[model samples]
Target: MEQFEAFLAAHLPSAASFHPHYETSLHQMLLGGGKRFRPALLLGVVQAYNTLLVPSAYHAALAIELLHTYSLIHDDLPAMDNADLRRGMPTLHKMYNEVSAILAGDALNTYAFEVLSNAPFSDKVIVKLVRSLAHNGGVEGMVLGQAIDCHFENQRLELEQVKMLHIHKTGKLIAASLQMGAYIVGRDDLAQQLYDFGIDLGLLFQIQDDILDVTQDETQAGKTTNNDEAKNSFVTLLGYERAMDEANALAEKVTRQMMSFDENLQRELSPTLTQYINRHKD
Candidate 1:
């Protein structure tokens, strides 16, 4: 983790033009500190499969982090969530300007592919990595989910439709994170299983976030809270108690799936997975 952090610090996205705050804004949220959950998932898989490749896998991990950060930056925009806080700090649009925040997000989004391209791997492997990230983070996955989410605000959705919205918006990229790690280590066979687990995990994560949005304060949650009142969030549709039940059930499913993995994979991922698999209770 220390090594990955150092790599991230050294490889932060930068623009060559002499735009005053452009470069600064590009690096701010990345440096501000996030859960780094996606990166951890990728690296943990690589370590489990082949520790020798862990160092090389850092590039993939970093790419995912860059992409995830870009999404967060955009998600906090006034036109989106209208959030004022993120990562325990003022949101980009709040601290600087919405234009700065948007451009920075674009830069980070493109830079994620650039970073992945530079990773020390064969061209074929790089192509696979690129496809996984782009497919999940792009229009077919997260963007589609966001579009549905925003378009459906203030309008109630059926429970299954709500799950579908979150599965596309939040679940796909997370599923890709685990799959990308499988690609890194040439474990395509396990990728599907891991991805399926990650999707459930991601749903649990969103439900938990919805719960936290209403339950935790700004100081405790480190970001805006109670901001989903107008959205078709799980809490809004299922109510808080039902949402908790769903999270608990998903957590149990994730645990069972994790235990069913190859012994070595389970052992390697336990350190990271344990911390997050049941985070709703936290």
Candidate 2:
């Protein structure tokens, strides 16, 4: 993890353009630091299979983080969640301006693909990695989910429908993260299984976020809280207690799924995945 952080710092995207604060605004959110959950999942999978590939895996991990940070930037915009804080700091739109936030997000979004294209991996693997990230993060996946969530604002969706919303919006990218790691390590056989597990894990993550959005304050959440009143969140539909029940059920299922992985992969994912799977309990 420490090595990955150092790699991230060393490889921090430099706008390098004449626009002065553009670069600063771009770097601040990425550097502000969230959980780095997706990157660790990808790198952890790679490490379980090939330690030597770990360094090369950093590119993919950074790519995921970049894309995710871009999403957060856009999500916090006035046109979206209208959030003021993220990563325990002022949101990009709040810290700078909406235009800066939008442009910065766009830059990071494209740069993520560029980073993946230049990754120090085989051409075939890089292609697979790029496709995974793009498909999951593109208009059809996370973007679609975001669209659904936004379009359905103030409208309550059925339980299964809400699950589908999150699966596309939040689950696909996470599943892709694990799938990308499998590609990097030549564990194609495990790709589908990992992706399936990641989907459930991602759903758990989103539910937890919804619960935290209500239960915690802005300070405790390190971001805007109680901000989903108009959104079709699980906590809103299921109630806090029911949401906790759902999380507990998913946590148990995810833990059982983790046991089914090969011992080394299980060991690799245990630290990060287990920590997150059970985070709602905290």
Candidate 3:
């Protein structure tokens, strides 16, 4: 994780030369502490296959993190969720201004693709990385899910509808993270399996998040709690107990699926998934 942070610091656009406030806002948000789950997933897949880190893998990981950061920024915008806090701090727009926040998000989004395209890999690999990211993070994936979420605001959404929305919004990039790692290591055989696992993992993560929003305090969570009651969340639809049960079930399923891999790989990957699940159980 430290290595990945160093890589980002070295490659990410410097805030030193740009509009001081704008660049500083971007730097603070991008470098802010959080679970680097997406990049970990990508790197875990590569380690499972090759047991070694690759330069292109680092680039891909950075790109995914940058993209994820951009999503968080935009999600908190006044036009979106209107969130005033993120990672326990004032959101970018709240800290600076709306226009600066928007431009920072835009810069991160474009820079992600730029990093991926210039990764030290074959053209075929680079193309695959770009396409996978675009497909999962673009119109058909996260964006579509966000659109649906905003469209259905204040309206009751059915179970399946909520699943579809989250699968696209939160799950696709996660699944793509695993797939991207598989591509980096040329593990085509494991791509589909990793993606399948990612779907369950992503849902589990989100469900736990929903549960925590109601169960934990703002200080403990490092973000606002009880904010999803008005949204189409599992806790809102299924109630807290049922949602927790669902999360536990998904965690069991993910563990079982991980066991399908080689013993060594399973051992290597299980801890990260386990920690992710256990972190929100309170």
lDDT of 3 by residue, 1-282 (tens): 677878888886665764668678768777778788999889887777775655558999989988999999999898878887788788899898999899999989998999998898899989989998989999999999999988888899999999998998899999999999988888888788888888878888888888888888878877667777568999999998898888888878877787788875676577677688665565
Residue range 1-282, candidate 2, lDDT tens digits: 889889888887786868869888878988887899999999989999999999999999999999999999999999999999999999988887899999999999999999899999999999999999999999788999999999999999999999999999899999999999999999999999999999999999999999888879988999999999999999999999999999999999999999988999989999998678878888
lDDT for predicted candidate 2 compared with the true structure: 0.93
Clash counts for the predictions, in order: 0, 0, 0
Q: Is candidate 2 or candidate 3 better by lDDT?
A: 2
Model 3 Cα RMSD, Å? Answer: 1.5
How would you encode candidate 1's per-residue C-alpha lDDT over 10-103 as one tens digit per residue?
Answer: 9987577777788999888999988888898899899888999999999999999998999999999999999999989999999999999999
C-alpha lDDT (0 to 100) for residue 157 of candidate 3:
95
**On a 0 to 1 TM-score scale, where does candidate 2 land against the true structure?**
0.98
Clashing pairs in 3: none
Q: What is the C-alpha lDDT of each candidate?
A: 0.91, 0.93, 0.84
Question: How big is the RMSD of model 1?
Answer: 0.9
- Candidate 2 residue 156 C-alpha distance from true site, Å: 0.9
Q: In model 1, which residue pairs have backbone atoms overlapping below 3 Å? A: none
Off by over 4 Å in 2: none
TM-score of each: 0.98, 0.98, 0.95
- What's every prediction's RMSD, in angstroms? 0.9, 0.8, 1.5
Candidate 3, TM-score vs. the true structure?
Answer: 0.95
